[model samples]
Target: MLSIIVAVAENNVIGKDNGLIWKLPRDMKHFKETTTGHYIIMGRKTFESNGRPLPNRTNVIITRDKNYKAEGCVIVHSLEDAIKEAKNDSEAFIIGGGVIYDLSMPLVDRIYLTKIRHTFEGDTLFPELNMDNWNITEKRDFEPDEKNEYPFTILTLDKKK
Candidate 1:
């Protein structure tokens, strides 16, 4: 199975200047827990923004640059190649920058989304999802806490049968 994991602001913002706009600890924790031990595929910019490979996960990077290389990651020139490399894993995660998210959205089986209640000014935004195509399999709402600035909801959506 292939899944997409992302946090988006009310305005659909996901990042600004190649970095995430929010610092929600719970969301971060959820991300780590969900993706651990899975094969994670990301675009070159997303991989660079993360600085290094995530521990305990197979990191696959999609980049147009044929010569690009990261010490702890498998670099591929296309999304198809990335998916092919992760085909043997029980589950593979699409962890993104906006472009990557947009490209992989149609191909993924599930989406793990953290929906923040506040709007943010950002250079990058998540693609608009056609909700009719997805069914919410799980949902949890959280109030703002000291460690998290805004109220948010964690939603697990599966492509509708």
Candidate 2:
């Protein structure tokens, strides 16, 4: 199953200046726990934002740069090739920069979305998805605390059959 793993603000903002705009340790923990063993596909910018490969997961970066190279990552020119690279994984994750998320939206089977209750100014935005075609199979809400900035909800949505 190809799933999208992302965190978006109320205004659909995901990042600004090539980095995330908020701090949410809880959300980060959740992300790590969920995607640890899976193949993670992301855009070149997303991979750069992270600085290095995430341990314990295969990092596949989709980029148009034919000569792009990340020491520990699999660099592919397109999303289709990224998916093909991880064909053996029963569940691979589409981690992202906005463009990658937008491109993968139609092909992913499920989404693990972290919906922050507040809005923010950002240069990148997650593509708006039509809720009618998805079913929320799992959900959990969290309140802001010392480590997490905003109240948010994490939803696991499965594409309706």
Candidate 3:
């Protein structure tokens, strides 16, 4: 199954200037815990933003240009190719910047969301999730930490069909 792991602010902001907005340590921990052993797919820009590959996971980056390549990352020209590569894995994670999330949402089976209670001014956002098509299977609220500017909630949703 395909899973999308994202941390979103109250207004749905996921990033700004190709970087993450919030520095929630717990949320970061959640991300690492959930995607550690999975195949993680992201856009070329997202890969660049990180400066390096995340450890303990297979990093696949999607780019339109066939010539583009990054060290230790599998580069593909389309989402179809990425999915094909991850087909044998029990779960493949769509970890992203805006464009990748928008493109991969429809093909995913579940989502792990960290929803911050504060809105941030940002240039990028998480894709709009269709509530009707997803069922919230788990939810847990977390108190604001020194690193996080406001309260947040962790939610896990599975596709209805």
**Every candidate's lDDT:** 0.94, 0.95, 0.90
46-107 in candidate 1: lDDT tens per residue? Answer: 99999999999999999999899899899999899999999999989999988899999999
lDDT of model 2, residue 20: 92
The list of candidate 1 runs beyond 4 A from truth reads none
- Give the per-residue Cα lDDT of candidate 1 at 92: 97
Instruction: Rank the models by lDDT, top first.
Output: 2, 1, 3
Q: Estimate the lDDT of model 1.
A: 0.94
Determine which window of 10 residues in candidate 2 has minimal summed lDDT. 141-150
* Lowest-sum lDDT 10-residue window in model 1: 15-24
lDDT of 3 by residue, 37-128 (tens): 88999998999899899999999999999789788888999999999999999999999979989988988899998889889999998878
Top-scoring candidate (lDDT): 2
